[model samples]
Target chain A: MKRELTCIGCPMGCRLTAEFNGTEVTEVTGNGCAVGARYAREELTNPKRMVTALVRVVGMERPLSVKTEAPIEKRLVFDCLAALGAVAVAPPVRIGDVILENVLGTGVNVVATEDIGG
Target chain B: MNMKTKRVDLLIIGGGPAGLAAACAAREAGVTNLLILEREDALGGILRQCIHNGFGLHTFQEELTGPEYAARYIARVQELGIPYECGAMVISLSPERRAVYVSRTEGIVAVEAGAVILAMGCRERPRGALGTPGWRCAGIFTAGTAQKLVNLEGRMPGKRVVILGSGDIGLIMARRMTFSGAKVLACVEIMPYSSGLKRNIVQCLDDYGIPLLFNHTVVDIHGRERLTGVTIAEVDGKKRPIPGTEQEIACDTLLLSVGLIPENELSAMAGVALSPATGGPVVDETLATNVPGIFSCGNVLHVHDLVDFVSAEAARAGEMAARFLSGEKTAGERIPLIAGNGVSALVPEVLSKRPEADVTFMFRPRAVYRNARIAVFRGGKQLAVKRARILAPGEMAEITVKQDAFCESEGELTVSVEEVGA
Candidate 1:
């Protein structure tokens, strides 16, 4: 089986095609860089995506933005958002401060993407 | 009414990327008594609402979210002790660098500055600007507005969405709404190609399996109060909807990411001579506009594809503003540059024969071309030419022409696309 994939590692967005044989990517073509091949393999096998969202700050006018420390399973994006929805923070929150430790049991911690309060 | 005019070494407008970066550079360049006035209650400009990643790769050498990227500069601004006022709206500006602004804290404040940097940024083109026939529906939103609602306010506009443009914002929202459980029907682009970065079209749209319909546009919008559907149709070569080809899609929201126009109302008020091509003030190699002691940069000068470039360009403008404040004038002729056959908008409309630094000239190609070369010629004499794998209007083309090329070209340097081998 063959599948078309676009490399999201960078802005180049090199269009790539992967030839798979029994869950193994045999070959990847039309990639501008090596990241594309790795991306195709991961995409064909177990795809992951980084999720960014905003959580409420206690008594603050604006919400604080956060992102998963690392890419999680693509299917868990909504579940991660739902998990984040129930969480609120008391700022002076600093960047990289863990908002949800291991969100959705995915082993990916959601951290603040900004410094709020302090 | 009597008001005291405050004097400052430099007065920067709009505390966004451009203004923040400019203030940092100016302060570093030894220009004290500078101020940044931002219209929003909080600094960071639109980045506050843009809570996504993939920003700051060029400047920080790492991918960062919008707010994260803004935080780096905001930290620098604070560390430098640069005074800035959020919620201060600049009302008027003079070519002489006089500015008047108003805010709740300080109503109708006047400032006399040695130099001013126009970094007011840009605004999205509304549906009224598109002239699309629709009965002022409720669910319709500009992608940025929807982004603000979703990311900032934690409110979802609708579950079923139909986006009307393929701009980066619309493409991102297609994925964002989907991540929050919205069904993105399709992303319709009037042009044959998308104006957004190729990365966005891939990750934001393709990753989620959303369809992108090229050469199509919404012909009619449905619903009396809240949007229920939009009538989309394939467009002809002239971009007009082809009759009898209308197709309706049922969706609660219609997001328009049609285009963005540089916010130049203040620049016009300042009497800065603007370029009809870039919709920005006509700037020279130093990013100095035709008006003396004033400079333009970032999206307000011309819409940039990346915020990294905005920070870089704003730093340059800041440095130039600092130089202008020093009261040093160079003796040189201001040679003009022309956008030839295949070029659309060229920034730094003019340059000096021997610029102090190598100038990086940027422009938009009129159309899509592959295996092409861009040539810079001065009346039959070709000064510089660079080959490109592919060039499109959606992506801006840039060339770093050395000072020697400027020295070689006596009068005008016309840049245009040509056959690769030619």
Candidate 2:
């Protein structure tokens, strides 16, 4: 399968075109550099992404926004958000405070980015 | 038709970090008569809306919020009693560096300057500009506007949100909305990876558990009265949405933080040559635009990721503009700046013809790299080289090429970045 992939891994926005002979990769072009090629291959085979969103909070003005401690399985973003919906944090939250421990049993802790004053 | 024309030793446009710093620097450099014109009523530009603390970590060695960081310099501008006009919008610039400004009550006013600094910062890109298929609705707000509404105006625009684009503003807003009692449904990015800093990705989104939908886009906006929901689809390798993968996510607001374009209409009207790479005026090391008397710096020269760098660059432009007014002469044989492979754009579009000075160039990489080498060449002869252990598009790269490379020689200078060993 011949495919074109855009390298959005960073600000460069590299345009990449790739050729795959069956399940094996063949050639890549239009990439400004090699990292784009690597991104394209990984993106085609096993795409990964960092997830961010919000969970409910008690005694606070609004919900507490949170993100996975690290990159989770890219395919599980929806499942992760579903899990985050039921989670909630209390007020007087400090930046870098852990809101959830062992999120989805992935050993990743959902943390807070900003301090919430009570 | 004779407008009120005032004369000043130096005139700086836009009252952002760059403009304020430029005015102060020029004043300290023995230029007494200086004027700064700002369109907004306030002095701080985009920084005013950024309520989150994280700024001044590098420059001040302490973390400060955007307004706090701005106040530090604004205080200096006040202490120096710098002359400035708020609510003054510069409509045009002459080739000779005269600024035409208009205010509601003041009407049309023109200011002739011995030197002018163009500090007009950049503007955000909206969803309509991306050619993305979506209904034009009331819920769409640029990340900055949304930031202004929530952080400054103290108004909650929506209770449920869907953000498009993962730039710093959008990413930061994802966290902000969650704190503002809104449910951020998801952040959709058409690209496979994020365009924001690693720290932001980790700190802003990861901490909040906000769903950042990567390689996805909002194909349709569902509400007509207000925002009801959004249709998001997974984009393939080519960034086109893959069919049968559409997922409807319920949301009331759609925030766009796609990108920024330098606000350079005045430069354009003045006939200053612009670089296609950065969409800003082509400037020499002195930050002088193609038009000798008109100078530009900060985000107006090129979009900068950090405000500290913007201030530093603007100070240089301010200092050089004062020198120009004091009879600093430019020699012939100015070298035009050219971008090389793996390099998106280079600033200070021209290099000085003299040998004793050092000229700095800020650039963005074309892709992510583990080990890279940035090299500067004149007429195909390598002039300067620097090594980078890691490089990413989110970060800006600065390199200074020695003035000697262009002193004795004349021609185009090319700045290229390449992966090590490749």
Candidate 3:
């Protein structure tokens, strides 16, 4: 099987072609750097992304911004967001405070990235 | 009440990536009495609200989130023991580099600095700037404001969304809203070409299966209490809406990511000459404005597509400001830089003869070009030429010219681009 993808590793946005043979990579081409080839390989199998979302905060007009500690599987993004939607925390929250632990068993915890004052 | 006055060798007007990097560079250059003034309760500025990754690729050679990229500089500032004041808003500035600010901790203070760096950054062009026919609505928000609301405040501005511009922020937010389960109907751009990075177009729009409409704009907005929908129409070459091509998109929110304008109110107050092309201060090779002791960099000098470039340029500005405070004169004659054919504008509108080192000139092409040659000319004599595979208005291009390249030239420099075949 042959697939064409744009490498998001950098702003260059090199168009990459990946050939796969029975779940085994055959060849990758048209990448500007080595990172693009690695990105194409991962994208062809078990694609993952870093997730950013919001969590409810009491006594505040808005929710607090949170993100996964690391990139999670691409297919699990929506499920992770759904899991984060049900969470709420009070104000006086500091940056790097964990909101959800081991989200969706991805071993990635969602933590606050901004300080919300009471 | 008694007013307190402070003196510093260098005063940076912002504490974001640009200001923070400038302060660190100035401190490292042996400027001990350097101070940074930030209006927010803490440092980091806008980066605090930008949680998505894709920053620091050039500076750090790794992709870092906005906060993480900022923390690196903030940690450096702390490690250097550089002094910075939070919740300090600079109210007024004079041509003599005197600044008056009011802070919560200190009522009102005056700052006398030998040199100042203008790093106020830029602001998004608001709805009023677009002049779209619309009623006063609640769901209309600038793309940056929406990003802050979603990323910092944890609020969804709307459910069904229609983004009015294809800027990087708008493209990123389209994916952000989609990941959060909001329906992003479409993205509209007035220009035929997208103004965002290609990486964003692929990762944010293509990945989410969102349609990007070119040569289109929102003509009318429908909403009385909240946003109901928006009427979009295709435009002609003049950008005026065409008849009978109107389509109404039922969206609860309309996000505008039109463009960014340099926040130069302070630069103007300080009597710095502004560039008509960039809407920022007109500076020379040393990043020094026409005003002797004042320098400008980062978004306040021009809107940069990458934060990495902002840090690099601001570092040069910091070092120059330090040298100015140390009473060292840059040895060279001033030569004007002209942006000719196919080039939109050039930063450091003037270059110095026999620069201490190779100086890089940054510019943007007026339009898209493939396989073009960017040439620098001095009185019809080509000094340097660089071949570019592709050039777009969204991306900034740069070329470095060695000091020896202009060793014998005493004439003005003209930078232009020409098609390889034509």
Task: State the TM-score, rounded to 2 decimals, of chain A in model 1.
Answer: 0.80
Which should have the higher lDDT, number 2 or number 3?
A: 3
* Backbone collisions counted per model: 0, 15, 2
RMSD of 3: 2.9
Tell me the lDDT of model 3 at B106. Answer: 94
lDDT score, candidate 3: 0.88
Residues B49-82 of candidate 3 have per-residue lDDT tens digits of: 7778888999999877788788889999999999
**Residue-by-residue lDDT tens digits, candidate 1, B273-323:** 888999989888899887788899999989888899999999999999999
Q: List the residue pairs that clash in candidate 1.
A: none
The DockQ of each candidate is 0.54, 0.05, 0.42
User: Which candidate gets the maximum DockQ versus the true structure?
Assistant: 1
Q: Could you give the CAPRI-style class of model 1?
A: medium
lDDT of 3 by residue, A1-118 (tens): 9899988765557899999775866799999889889988888887888887778887776777778988899889889989988998987987788999999998889987766775
DockQ versus reference, model 1: 0.54
Candidate 3: true interface contacts recovered: 0.45
